[model samples]
Target: MDQAVIPFDWARMLLGEEPPTFLLEILLRTIVIYIYTFGLIRWIGGRSISQLSMVEFLLVIALGSAVGDSLFYPDVPLLHAMLVITVIVLINKGLDYLILWSDKAQTAINGIPNWIVRSGRLNPDQTSDRGIGKAEVLALLRIEGISNLGEVEHAFLEANGDLSVFRAREPIAGMPIVPPHEICPLPHVEPSLREGEPSPKLCCFDCGMLQSRAETACLHCKGEVWTEAKMPDSRLA
Candidate 1:
């Protein structure tokens, strides 16, 4: 095994230096802190650092504070710091391994995403588990001008440190929403036209077949709903 020998510096202070050993000590401490921080970050995870949960969030803050120690203490030897960092990194890796190997352990540490909204209802159990209440959810919804859960087609607490939602319908407008199920397309039907002038007047969406002389039906097929009006072809309107 290779070993690093860091000797104590005690004479620089006596050579008219402003406690030169203090500077070395600070450097040493910085090295140690850097190692630990790097390892912990790597092991616990740094790729998705911004997505840490509650406890992990706290650790990240603490990690920042630990890194700040370098600003005040510099005498810490770099090798010792590296050693500590390596150990921390190892520990992080060990924890991750445990999480990966055990399903139950993974759930205990980092929970899986849960369905907070289902069947147009906010699940109370799921809300509580995420440490969030209905009020918060509603508040978020309100921010998006959503008044009722019915407006939501799908809502879930994402493990990526966010709450995402999708709504069912087109929202009475050109809305991009999360659809629960694929739309069952209506069978293709030809458009109806007014009977006259060689060909019938093409169905225009702007003014549906509903003219002053309108009956309650598609003029040609007599189908009550002018389905074609709502179809993509309606863009010609």
Candidate 2:
């Protein structure tokens, strides 16, 4: 080993002894592969890593492994790797075609979008099916700048696993349109007997009349029952 070190093979050092191809050949091959992979990815709907779907992720892994091995390994044939990549892209395109033409195929490949919130109410049933909890929903809401379910008109668990939130165009004054499960009961206030007390404490549900008490009937409209006026929270304001 010492004797061999004394006489350095400059040519071998500069250009690999058992080179897969010439230096020029390797350079061209690498360039070709890079360009081809980029075009393929673009054709197959390229997305940022954070936005990648399962199929896109798998495609990235497969392309990276194959291209990297062929670029440096003397034993790996470039043409063979290229062929494999080409076949993979072809299969991906085929799947895309199927997805476009067949509803079942699209649902199977991409999954259906789940409605997490509808009409300002959380969809408990939808979340349960997808293994999502209320905490996760709340976190997602915050990500979309929503402080509470009351502000959301509709929210969806997209097919790619992202939360898409839609806000109400015209929010109700005090009543949040949220689901029945999330409605909070208010404290009942007794009707004031004194004439000097606060006037018309609640509004009749059936009629527009305001009354100081939760009367059996509205005085003006002769309607039954009333609901307390709800004010918007500080966060909403």
Candidate 3:
């Protein structure tokens, strides 16, 4: 017959079915993984943790699983986890070298920086290709205290997922993104202006390209929807 269960078997609960010497093995296992992890991290370049590229991100995920599993699971041997970690780190290092030596390799693995905004207009092709929306770009611009797209000359979505923005020396009329579209929706322009009147500056709702109100559609995006282009508020500028 099976042994009766004991409710308050503290020794069995704490120590488990293994011998007390297994505690020593656990300690050794932890030390080895800790040292190996530390050494591998040190060997890797001192890039900011916030800026982890694709390969670095993969290294973190693999090491985290292997190290955590070996640390507590009695069945998992330290050497096995260590070997996995070593192989992953070696592959990561090799990829790093390849990235350094070959532009094509770097582009393939890390991705190329995409021009999200150029000449105060959103690059719809690049932004859509990168799976970035106008709202996201606007949020990043807001972080940089940009009130409107007119204030930006250029903005790039970096390979490491950072936004790089350059301010325009002479700002032009552009679509206002601040206060968000939800709070203050873009003001639509009337279809027709008075005869012989100068055309009002209008921007494509989709791509933010400035154009004359006389045009039926935006030249950049061929979008029919448009709103009055806003000049940057001097106070915000």
Q: Estimate each model's TM-score.
A: 0.43, 0.51, 0.75
Which is better, 1 or 2, measured by TM-score?
Answer: 2
Per-residue alpha-carbon lDDT of model 2 for 27-109, expressed as tens digits?
A: 55645665476455433332133376645665777678878876776555555566557766766677778888999987766
lDDT of 3 by residue, 56-147 (tens): 76688778998898677655555566666776677778889999999998876677777999989999888776667788888878888898
Question: Which regions of candidate 2 are displaced past 4 Å?
Answer: 1-50, 170-232, 235-237
TM-score of 1: 0.43
Measured with C-alpha atoms, the lDDT of residue 118 in candidate 1 is 55
> Per-residue lDDT of 1-237 in model 1, one digit per residue for the tens?
734333444332122234545545645664566556545543443224436753355345544554454234444434433433444445456657878799986765565776776534456677666566655655555556554444566777765446678876742111111221124322323343556523322321211232223344544335453222222212221
- Number of the candidate with higher lDDT, 1 or 3: 3
On TM-score, the candidate that comes out on top is 3
Rank candidates by lDDT, best first: 3, 2, 1
Q: Which one wins on lDDT?
A: 3
lDDT of 3: 0.75
Local distance difference test, each candidate: 0.46, 0.57, 0.75
